[model samples]
Target: MKTQSKKAMMIGTLALMLGTALAACGSNGNNGSSADNGAANIQSANGAKGADGAAGPNGGTAAGTDATASPDLSKHVKLTWAALGDPPKDFDAVKARLNEMTNKDLNADVDFVWIGWGDLDSKYPLMLMSGQNVDMIYTAGWLDYSGNAKKGAFTELTKDMLDRYAPNAEQKLPPEAWSNATVDGKIIAVPRNFLEYQDAGLAARGDIMEKAGLTTLSNLDDVETYLAAAKEADPKVVPFNTGASVGDYPLTSFVTRKKALVSVPGLPANMLQFDPLETKPQLTSSFDDPDLLAAYPKIRDMFLKGYINKNVLNNKTPSRDAFKAGQSALAAYGDNQFRDAYNDINAAHPDWRVSFQSFSPEGPFIKLAYDSGMMAIPSASENKERALLFMDKFFSDPNYYMLMIYGIEGKHWAYTADKSQIEVPAGSDPSLYPKWQYPWGFGDWVGFNKPSTTDYPDYAKHVEYMRSAAKDNPYANFKPNIDSIKNEIAALNNVFLKYGGALAYGAVDPDDALKKAAAELKAAGYDKVKAGIQKQLDAFTPGS
Candidate 1:
């Protein structure tokens, strides 16, 4: 009787393991619908829906009681985590410290894989194709999230799995974030819970703004006035140095107004403009907009009047470099870029105070939550549950998150005398302890420590301002599946690469350039791609 009882217990344990394995590998059954045959439809809406997965053998329970229950400290597990960028020289040391904590708290260790920026495009795809033993990966819209999701490269983060392993994170993440992460009604990634307002504008020399007799630069006229002052002040300095490309600053009309659908690059046929005030959103070509058209001539005038660099069409020098070298007075900048510019300029030229000016009177522009950043579990991972558990700890536990981002507290960084902020110790060699400030890619922003007072005096105020005044894109959660129009998109990109920069910089005649680009786009099946986009837009119901 004793032997029989032991045999029954062993069989039940084996069954449970088998069941868990099967559940992890099962299909999510939410492959998004494909575009209908013919002109691909393009409509404007928000959000996609995903189907939930069936409960696993352990019966999805609360935080600690699920089938993949709280990790067993007695048994050890190791996971492979891949993040973008070059590995730090002290990576092994950091990993050793990280493992010490993880082993004690979660009974697991992580083998971090750093994919350098230059190698990501090639390496990531190969890993997915070869079904490498990678567990978690840093992914983002700009980093091919849509493409990888479509290819089943990432696991479907079902509600049950989330509840079982990352209940706190599931509840902490905003609804909009989940909506953005969903593809074909299945959540394929866990987006970081960070608030970032990427309002685009310009950074200029403070002396130039004062010399231009301008207190504020909120519009194109103000920008022109500032440029003129800088030119008059110094003949050697380009008033507005716009590097080799025309850049997105020229499309301030679209960006500042939030009229453009900021989809992943190479997907849209043209700059698809929309009216945020409209009850019903519609996609229109910026090339066809009269207001947008007017900006082209103005750009041309600036180019001709010598307000902008004459060699701007193919200038390889970065605007920041030009500023450092005293070759440029003004450069296009995003909100955070201004801070960096200020720091660099202040370090180099203490007498020259650098300041930033926003073009949009509407304040900061809020990007979609998912656009902030995300980490995803690969579909090929056998240790999905362990990975999810680690993610939860990374997001919810300040110690883990801080350790991963800033490194050892006393060694890599130290608190200020008042303990209100953190900073490197005096006389410490930074190279010995590299700080990877990639919170958006690894963990929740809510867990991040407050910035040191020395870094930004008004850090708290800035956060409050962004929370209160930043405007979200009305179409923030819209996800268009453009598999059918890939060929057309490729063709459009080629044409844009050849002629778009010239048009953007006013280096070419607008009328002739626009007509020729339009003609070529049509030949490349632009209309068909537009239709397909319209179809997805029409079918989409925001937050449905």
Candidate 2:
């Protein structure tokens, strides 16, 4: 977020941010930050507000301003949106823009209710049952996408409605992905599209590596070398710092050689959306896998050698922040986190260099089943037409996309000499930066407006470079029917919780942790999930 308020700059920055957030998907089939968690039916933050056109059951009343019966949308419509941290700097301006656009595009008015960062899931569920009449909502598993779909918190969109009203959004998406979003054959959510893959990877400080006498880092060996160099250069800093939630990374990076670990989501042999495969309709969850067979030992070794920062296990600070502080050499994360921290690192470490790698092995990654981020129609909305129109304009209107993302161009940002770069516009106050998150719905990769009269390097090359490095996990669109194994899924998560973290974090003996978890899963119907997935895969063998 920058101080300017140009729409173009906002959109471009938004795209960059989204690309980073959704980099996992945009990069081919990986997620940059596990934070987006837009995986499979995870209701995305940017949901649909029904588009304007012919209205049917989802339409409003004639007593209101709608063409037919006017239902007094301002009175009846209540919407709730979920998000991280506080709203952006120009949040009011953005909402004003939305209200103005709503009046222009449709004849209804509405408001966006916000839910804070505090314990979202527990609170969101309460909100759902409160009968508060929320018109649209943001959801994910943590926010309960699957749970809510089952609980009937959202209204399902009829296919006819999508085609007739939201043809633009419907046409833009890849087909099978749409199929995965249906609950009992009803489209309950709007899927989020991203540019990069969502898989985990590494973020290394170039300056630290340079001092460590390493120019490139493709493996843990390089990381070790870099850490040693950093300590030698400045003993004050811990060469490595990690979150308790992410301890698995160092373990995985060491085991995989140069690749980042993958948590595929399908049955055995049939990879999930995260896998690299020509054919497969399944996903794999590496979280509980023995790949840690190697990962555990390596990470344990690092821990013993004091190669990692001493405060890692207790460090509640964000990994990206630690990197930005130059307290660590490598930050293990996805493309999403790296981007959020990238600018800061550049600013803080102007003399430093930066690069990334994955913690998974260098070869034969798993295929992930379909992953998703969603937007949903709140059962509470009365102004569906206006809401839909807003989204349509939001994605399709170049100007709106730009405005929502970058703010007013000349005031928010300026293009470089070659018109290749977007920097904070001159004379803008960095403190009052306007924040716009565009990647919420639009894909990670897109060109809002080309340079009119300049020729810098191809800014689009970064897109090309990432695309070249990507391979869609053929199973990216497949999702299994988990109704039969729903209970088991919960039980398994509990079991994994008990021993999984211990194993991944090396908090407990690896052998004991794996044994306990495997045994617990086995007794709790681990095979049931595998079989359930197998049954679906067999049904779609043609794709396999």
Candidate 3:
């Protein structure tokens, strides 16, 4: 979630490094701050109707119209939204508090539908394709946002709609956020304005480390040492309890340690690689990386030594949950996930010490793609205006935003005395009312975002380090139009799963599986896909 006060701080920090981002076209030839020109330009570009035309969805005035008049809040309406993850025990309380504001402001109430992590892959598309009653749903780059948008699953957002409904967000969000969310020249979702470093790492029990006399984990070898020690100390405990769905320790290690390769956006299974340092954007098959090949043996060794679970391919439980339940000694995931693990574990077992270590502590940090998290409305939604209006509160009102993110303050979490930081409240059981996994469409910077309070010291330190170390990714806004190579991408993805999955999981020797996988990928049209992506990359200008 993004907070209003933090905008200046983030902007100031980004100003020193992130130079001017690529502004969205039709942005009045500048940043998208001037609503007047932006709306008119969008009207021309989208061919939206003017004021005299039929009303837009939810009985709202047509786009490109004079929207100075306030919306009619006389009629009470109910909206249904779908967000990621399981709902907390105090969800009713949080929703009730949120509706109080919406009821008074927009005369609307909302029902939040929670979609668990496992269901997201199948359910997101089903909800859209089935024409469900969901007014809004959480979407992201990894969730096939462009694919869904192309399928007419989402509404095309115009600047007039934002200006009239979500004025605060329309004014505050940087141009890059909108530019990145644009698919085929239509803004499909509202991109979160928060700056995030989506780097990978592992969390370990600090208490165990102290007892074993182990040093801080700085690299892969250190992690292996800690895992081995933990395994020796307790043979029953799975040292690394991770699964195939999210990510693996091997890829995270190579990425941060080597600092040369990055996962291509929208291409999972490490099918394609991008080098941000390249003067011209480049994409190559991950199978060709020599460093990755060298690392496979190390991962295989860990698998053979019983440090990682042999049934990792079938493991469905999130690593964080396993870590908290005392099922594992090492929890491997992105750096951002450590906060939840720390919060839950500290709440349950006060004596336990949890800490996170980046595989590479310095260098090679790229900020997250702006569209990594977003709020999107389905084409079936009849309350489109109301949904936008509700989302607007997240940006316009800090209290509403805070309540949505942190829950009922004292009951769920509390701010420190100085109000500069957040911390768990006394006697609160974090597991009973977990932090909302989906921050929705906002990040703290745009006044739409996430906020968390942890008793763990390393939590705050990690955030500061990421903020200081973050670098601009030149291709952050470049979204490859995979529509042309959909068949090829699908085929290559299957090859990665059948062959690359085994190699990545350390189940097979790279010597045998790697060549077979490369051969299969070529037969599946890997070259055509790579060339198509490269062509798109060549046409992209970072700050155009």
> In angstroms, how far off is 34's CA in candidate 3?
26
Better of 1 and 2 by lDDT: 1
lDDT of 1 by residue, 1-544 (tens): 0011222112111111011100000000000010111111112111222223222212234355454555445768889987654455676777898899878877888897765332333566678768988989866654447767887899998877887777656756656567667778888887755534444445577787888888767666777787888888987777777543212233233232434234332242133434433466666654555665777777677767887776654454545457667877865544433432354467677666776555453543343445436778898897898888888886668788777766778877787788656677776545554444443444555545445423322323543454556555666566677777778876765555555455455566788878987898799887887777767766766444
Error of 2 at 20 (Å): 10
1 versus 3: better TM-score goes to: 3
TM-score of each: 0.70, 0.70, 0.81
CA lDDT, every model vs. true structure: 0.55, 0.46, 0.60
In model 3, what is the error at residue 79, expressed in angstroms?
A: 2.0
Measured on C-alpha atoms, candidate 2 has an lDDT of: 0.46
Per-residue alpha-carbon lDDT of candidate 3 for residues 99-164, written as tens digits (9 for 90 to 100): 888888889998888755434435657899998988988776555577778889999888678768
Predicted structure with the largest lDDT when compared to the true one = 3
Model 1 / residue 348 / CA error / Å: 3.0
Q: For all the candidates, what are their Cα RMSDs to the real structure? A: 14.8, 9.4, 10.2
